[model samples]
Target: MDEFAALTERNRQLSKAMMQSVFELACDLSGLGPFPEQAAKARGTAPVNARLMQIQQLIEQLRADLQGLRGPYLMQQLQGLGVDQHSRALQLHIGSGPYVLDGWINLDVFPAQLSTNVLWGLPFVDGQCRYVFLSHLLEHLFYPTDAMALLQDIHRILEPGGVVRIVVPDIAQCIAAYQDGDTGFFRDRVEHWGAGDGQATRLEHFLAYAGAGPDPAWLFEAHKFGYDQETLIRALQRAGFKTILPSTYMASTHSALRVDEHSQIASAKHGDRHYSLFIEAIKE
Candidate 1:
């Protein structure tokens, strides 16, 4: 037990030292001058990126330690992410990952993933979301019209400076892939689902009244309509967002692409042909 405690302390110290070294090196590269002592009083803390990275590293090290110990490791990791707050009262949105890193509220009209149903209607929230994040959610809706209305509702719910961040698979990119004749094998994956305006229920949607079904053009089994970057950007502008970040090639932008190793591996294996567009819009 004493040896285990000593190893844990050693790992933590190593992580902290690595972070401090990286920060100082960054400061040097930027010609920031030894991270001025005066800056400490003026700025009050470290930059957000450095802190977030440190937290992530610490989590990784702790997870490794838990595995070495062999029991309750996953639970410890979940506790680190605050996953203990799961509740039936909350409506979970579909495709929501375990953590809400960017401070988005887990909400949906239907409880699918990690959301509590329709947070917009809740009395105390007062439409003050920091940002609304949707992961491949919009394409599943049948009524693009009602989906636009939902965005407007989101705008209404947000505080003045708050923004919405949406990420959806781009249909145009897939069509471009098909037209380019990349690979006959890949062409088989092109689905042609149609969008119809009705209360469509599918097993994945839990047979609940989903606003619309998948568009039949690109995805036959279950995709409604695929969106190109232009269509999505224009739609958000019409929905009353004051500022929409310019859409660019996801691979090119620093902030646009999440550069995690897992994302890189997945993209490489699957030929990232699907279009994923992200939008950041401020409420007017």
Candidate 2:
């Protein structure tokens, strides 16, 4: 870690020095200040200019690559493909890390159906999809901006009357369990994820998802925002969705979206309380 930090600083310093040298030479050459025959030698800058142009092109390409993991856009551009109406329905599992749904197109940043970053936008025409499933992904997006952008895009891509099932770590449930000192709840969660022996660590289990594993996939699941039932409902409503409902494990009206990791975790003892919030909303 120390070596990485030192190397990063050294690279920045070297880049700054290189830029300064280039700028000073360019200024000196332009005015013929250093040498009497500098005007004739000015043509030598053509190679430097060409190299800078190439560098600019490379920088622009990197900018696009960083932000333009646009799966649908790339599909259309590279493969001449877009999500057309499926023979049945266009179902999308956005941010589906490893849980690949058999029938639905598993779209995620973790190299699923397409390496898609949902924060940019879904790669489909408006009203092309029938159902979208977001599993424990919303909280990872920054609140009211990035999170809301994803929600608004989901509304736009769904056919009218289409549905979105959102899941997130239930902040309210976690808080309640902590207040009531429900060790069993914490115990179960810790055991399932295989960490957190104490009350505080177990509580941390529900709040944070990102720093748990070495995999980049888990790194993406960091809880940037927290959501309870009412807060989630209001966010959905703002995104132009209607008919929002607080749902439960394996109880979705949409049969295909009922596929979740929740059913196994929710215990029979704690009134079947799930560690994650399940909510569904309609694009109306």
lDDT against the true structure, each candidate:
0.48, 0.71
**The candidate that achieves the highest TM-score relative to the unseen native structure:** 2
The C-alpha TM-scores of every prediction are 0.45, 0.66
RMSD of each predicted structure = 23.9, 11.0
How far in Å is the alpha carbon of 87 misplaced in model 1? 18
lDDT of 2 at 278: 86
Number of the predicted model whose lDDT against the real structure is largest: 2
* lDDT measured at residue 272 in model 1 versus the true structure, 0 to 100: 38
- Worst-scoring 10-residue span by lDDT in model 2: 210-219
Model 2 residue 29 CA deviation in Å: 36
Off by over 4 Å in 1: 1-104, 108-125, 184-221, 247-274
- Give one digit per residue, the lDDT tens place, for model 1 in 1-284: 59987887687567566756666666674786545544655798776556658977998898688556533533454344354433212122223544333433343322222333221222223444444555556665544674676667666656776656666665555555455654432322322222243332232222111223322222312445566778787878877886877543333233422322222211222243333555557676
Model 1 score (lDDT): 0.48
Error of 1 at 182 (Å): 2.2
Candidate 2 segments whose C-alpha is farther than 4 A from its true place:
1-61, 65-73, 76-88, 196-219, 261-271
